[model samples]
Target: MVFYLTNLLALLAVFVILGLSFNLLMGYAGLFSIAHGAFFGLGAYTCGMLMRDAGWGFLLAVVAAFALSGVVGLILGLGSWRVTDIYLVILTLAFQVAVVGLFANLDITGGSGGLVGIPSPSVFGVELASPFRIVGLAWVLCAVVAVIVYYVVRSPYGRVLKTIREDEIAARSLGKRTASAKTGAFVLSSALAGVAGALFAVHLQFISPAEFGLGRSIEVLSLTIIGGLAAYWGPFIGAAVVVIIPQALTFLELPNSLVGALNGMAFSLLVLILLRFRPQGLLGRRSEAPVGDGGGRFAPAEGPEPAPSSAVEVRPASTATVSRDGGAPHSVTAAGAPPIEQPPPGDGATGPQGRKVRTLRCENISIAFDGLQAVSDVTLQLRPQQITGLVGPNGAGKTTLFNVLSGLLSPDEGRVLFGDDDVTNIAFDKRARRGVVRSFQDMRLFEGMSVRDNLLAALTPTAHEWIVPIGLGGGLRRPRAARADRRESADQLIDYLGLHDHGDTLARNLAYAEQKLLMIGRLLATGADCYLLDEPMSGLDQSGRDRVLRLLRDTVEAGATICLVEHSLDVVREACSSVAFLSDGCLIAEGPTEEITGDRELAAMYFGT
Candidate 1:
């Protein structure tokens, strides 16, 4: 029983490391990586081959393997520029398969017979042997990793990573440079896995190419899925389960094929359970300040990303964990303005005669979808520094107008011009690159990332070309650039939304009001002259509604033209100078908010008496 338990724990140790590292990328970072085998195999091979062929010390060879794995990870980081989720899975799969072929084909790897005689680690020249010793060492290593990972998750760096995973677009808007963050995550995660692989090689003293392949990759993935996505200890629980289950079955004299089949069946059942029930995983809370041990009110539950223990103490009674950084509270006013959040360049709205130029003009804009005219003959002009409200009943084409103007959907017959440039045909992403941005009514925040990083990532340009030049090829030739430049902006925005205390809180953990305003901060980072906000006040309570109105007023005061599609008369009265009412895709009224507010005909259109 002792022997069986030791072996089970041993196997579980390897998978715990794999799952933790994998979570760093997949769960917390919002990536679906399948390159675990390649990294693991490379680390294992490098350690085994170097020690065996060169007669290098066991520890030295492990270091070499770890370095080699990191290099491979850096090479793989290039994929972050243009891939995600399914695409990433495919890329890593290809790499894993290719590595297996290389191990088989290469003469150095002993070509299928595998590397043998890999001596174990020695403490001052003492060979590390015995299952008991191995388990102790392995657990120690895992503990160290957990500690380091804990810091990483809670650190500002991890905050940004979560932001990228949660909403890459939002992160880009906040100036996070999603590509750079994603690449960094890949390297970090791979290095962790590489260390694990090196240890495995040391333990076995015999290496086979088969030990590292898609099967192993699948195994690590299983650990993550079984334990939990965005779960800190889910990896450990998952590893124990997969390892122990197999070992238990083996003790029962199950055939090898039957064991594999059973694992498949068990994994399938887990998938179903996760889909139907808690999709986040066991040991995983849904969202983050931290929860009590019992799991009630799992709001703002931290993921693999650790909380700032020093910055804020976990108070079970409090809904927020207040960060002591600058003594900022949970909700505070925005810090008036930043020193460098300059508006869009070149078209600064200055005319030849020194008067401000017209920033936007929508003349007779019309759009149709499937023979339904969702927007028609909508004439509007957006000037510098004004808040405009677009209101109508449900299905009145308010969102459609935003979509058309933001370049998500093209208008059938219309002229949409911005600062003397006709961008009616521009694509949505291109418009964003050129400083035209819009937020969705659905509030698509990255599900598991912290609020601070979400805002920071939103400040970066999302285009891969701009992003790629910043992180590689001498990192755009920049010098001493810190990752927290937009942090001030993000902080200010967080303060504005009363989420300064929850800056490190995951997006999924935020109250409904918080998510709505965070999206606004994301839009603010775009530095667009013309803003299109769809249903900005949809779910806000009375206080949140007032806060949003203040934001709109302040935004317009900051010299930007905002088009808000909302239903709140008080908000419209408070923030909007001009109002455009849409009915069944047609512009029925266009005037001042006060003029339209008392209009009986428009009142009849909405509130039937």
Candidate 2:
């Protein structure tokens, strides 16, 4: 009984490692790879071959297994750069099959006969020869892995993984190397799985191709889902349940074949029931309801609604006078806050010469989709410290032009210049790093994160966003001063955007206007010099519009260039100094806002008279 119990505990420990490592991809990074079992098999074979052929020690063999698995995982992760979702699922599934087949055919791996005589591991010359010793060793390693995973999930790097899971595009737009992050997650997760595999081989003293197969992959995934995704104790709870269930079934005195079938049915039934009733799993958190959902956690407290007109009014603690680039002073007050006090110029606000800013210019830029021109021969320039409006009718190529300028799409015909440098070939994230950023019409905020966290995620050059630094220094590697500054900046932005009270609220929980403000806050956090805003004032009330206009004015005054894409001519006239109008993928008119709006022919075209 003692030996049986020890064996069960060791097996549980191995599965726990599998569960935690797999969660890094599926739960944290939102990647679903079915090749985890194949990686396990790779590790087992690699370790077994090395120890048997090369006479390597247990520790050295495990390290070799980890390195080999990591390299293979890196190759698979690179594939993720090209495909995702169902296509990625298919890719991994194919890989799993191929790897299992290779294991069954490779002579070096002992082929169908499988590898045998994997020696038990030793610590400092003390052989872990007994089941009790092996259990203790396995659990110790399991505890270490758990601790490592705990730190990783709690670190800034983990936050980036979650951000990628939530919205990869938004993360990329904020200058995150999302592909690299995903690749790193893959390599680390696979390496850990390899460690588990090595442990499994040593514990059993044998490894068969049958042990690591599609069913094993499904079993790992099942345990993770059953325990809870993104929960710390989830793997432990899940592995325990999975191990205990099959053992418990033995008490029924069923035949061996019947026991296997019944166990599979039990797990499948449990998964179905949990998915229907408790989708988040036993330890997973329930999704928070959006605000105004009948007094949900994020709902506004029971109180009289504030007057709509006063919603955007700033309520600073004290009044102050501020100016930008020695410009005219603006009175910043608390009550009835008419003019907002512009904060100090950000790093991207001005060039070396004060108030000098880089201009974004597109020359003869054209692009087409499905043989239909979306933007045709558009030549435009957005000058520094000014708000330029890109106005157009529906399907007029305004958004297409924005996409080209922001590097989301490359123009078929011409060059994009940022000041003197041509940035036509730069990636969108690279362009963002060069101080050009944009906001989406759909307001792609990280809905799972709080408003403050949204802004923090957008803050560039984060110190501990890489695995190496984070693993080496742990929490101390996160520069405290830099983190504090980012937090302070996030707080100031929350207040500036009139979202002070909603800083802790999830982005999805905010009202429509508030969510819009948070989007702008995220843009500001990127510290970009040029902003391309798409329908920023759309669906906003007068007060909300007023707040955005004021913020734009402040940003322009601080020496940043802006391009506003707006449908409302009134808003364009009120907020923009220059306007470029597009109609049917063509640049119909361009010049000062007053000149363009005053033209009767252009007015007719705009109003469709």
Candidate 3:
């Protein structure tokens, strides 16, 4: 019975490591990797092979396992660099299968048999032969790893990872190397899994290919989701329940395989239910409910408005020059559509390289869905440092056009040139890295992370400065001079945006307008070359809109370009340098705000001229 209890405790310890590792990616980073099991397997197999074949000691095996798994994860991260969401999952799935298959037939992997007799580890000469010692070892390892996990999530590098998870494009434009950030997460996650695998092998006195299978990966994912993503304790709770419950059943006369199957079914249902009702998982703070307690799957609803959608149902954005109501010739007034607020052009444009940069050129861009044209023959440009508005009736392709420019969608025809770079083929991440950034129409910032950190993370990839560097140095790089310069810059930007006091506050802690500003701050902090304001003045009252307008001006003065997509013509009239009218994905007219509104064709389309 003591042996059995020890076994259960050891498993629980291992699961704790798994939970924390998985949560770093999902809960904090907001990346959902279905190949967690593959990472786990990589650690186990690599360590097992190194020890059994190389005659290495326990510590050596652990090192080998982590290093090998991390290397593989880095490679995989690069491979999946361009893959987003659904495609990313598919790519990971393919990689998972490939990794598992390689182990299945390889001589080093012991084929289907797996490596056995992976010799139980020892500290000095005292072998980890007794169950009590194993349990103690597992707990000690868990504690050490737990400390590291705590530090990582709270560190600057961890903050950047979460930002990337929230919105990769935004992170990129903020001067963050998103690919590298993602690779960092992958490497860290894999290393933890490898370390856990090393411990598992030592605890069990064996290793098997069958042990680290896809189901195991799913189990890891389940623990993260059910345990409550976005919070530090969520993983601990999840790991304890998952590993302890299953282990207890083994001693209760149930077969080990049966325990595995039960776990599988239970976690499957767990994920499904979480998705249906509580997408945020247990400890995760909800992003939608702008004003609520920081945790769960929920959104505040003042009315019957539909839930806003973005990547992860929490975040992601775009461009353009049009409003929905076709502007009538000679009737284009300020604040043209409802909900869009017009601000005075108080500040100048934040141009390129301290130079007044202007000019946005979209050449013959087109978009279609299932052969039906959603936006076709779309050609539009917004002058530099000036607000260019896109307006037309609903479904006129204004939003679609925004997606194309922001690299969210690849146009079926033509190309997009932002001051000369052919952005036509650039991935969303790449485009963002090159100075293009967007705010979600839905406003999806990291809900659980501190509000101040949200802004900081936006600047993180670009700031490249730090208060102090970590010993591991696997995450954020912090040199004194760079760090000081960035902090000063960030502090000034935050103060200018009137969020200096709220820097330490979590995103969900803010009000609706505050959240919007937080997002805007993120863009500014990240150093967006091009600011695509998608309904920026949406959901704002007069004061909030005024504040945003003021910020826009500040951006222009800071040398940033601005493009406004809105339904309000009055707002455009007061703010835009030029306007492009879109009707059913086709550009009906383009010129100075008044000239385009005066076009006879556009006037008729908006309201029978």
Best TM-score among the predictions, by candidate number: 2
Per residue, candidate 3 scores C-alpha lDDT tens digits across 1-609 of: 777778878988988888888888777667778787778878777666676677777777888888888788778778767777888788888887888888788987788987887776777667777788888888998898788788787666676777677666555545556676677777788788888888887887676677877778778888888888867888887887677666656667877778777767777887789888988777776654344345222322122222222101111111111111111101011121222223322224433334435355788888799887988777776566556788887888889899898888898899998665688888766676666777778777776667657655655543332212331333344455644544555555555555546666667667676677777777766555577878877766655665666666656644456887888766777567678888878887787888886677777786645
In candidate 2, what residue range of length 10 has the lowest lDDT sum?
318-327
> Which is the winner by TM-score between candidate 1 and candidate 3?
3
Backbone-clash count (model 2): 0
Which candidate, 1 or 2, has the higher lDDT? 2
For residue 544, model 1's alpha carbon misses the true position, in angstroms, by 6.6
Model 2 over residues 1-609: C-alpha lDDT tens digits?
998899999999999999999988888888999999998888888888888788888889988998999999999999988899999999999999999999999988889889998877877789889999999989987998888888788766788888898899998887777898899888888988898998889989899999999988988899999998887788888999889999999999999999999999999999999899998888987766566546443233222344545444454552223222122323222243222223333324553225446789999999999999999998988866678899877889999999999999999999999877899999988888777888898888998778888877776354457777534313556567755765766676677667767788878878776777778768766667788999998887666676677777766665567898999989998888888989998899888889998989888877788
* lDDT of every predicted structure (CA atoms): 0.68, 0.80, 0.68
For candidate 2, the TM-score is 0.90
For candidate 1, the lDDT comes to 0.68
* TM-score to true structure, per model: 0.67, 0.90, 0.73
Model 1, which residues run further than 4 Å from truth?
1-9, 123-126, 129-137, 267-277, 286-382, 389-438, 447-518, 521-532, 538-547, 557-561, 565-574, 578-609
List the candidate numbers ranked by TM-score, top first: 2, 3, 1
Choose 2 or 3, whichever is better by TM-score. Answer: 2
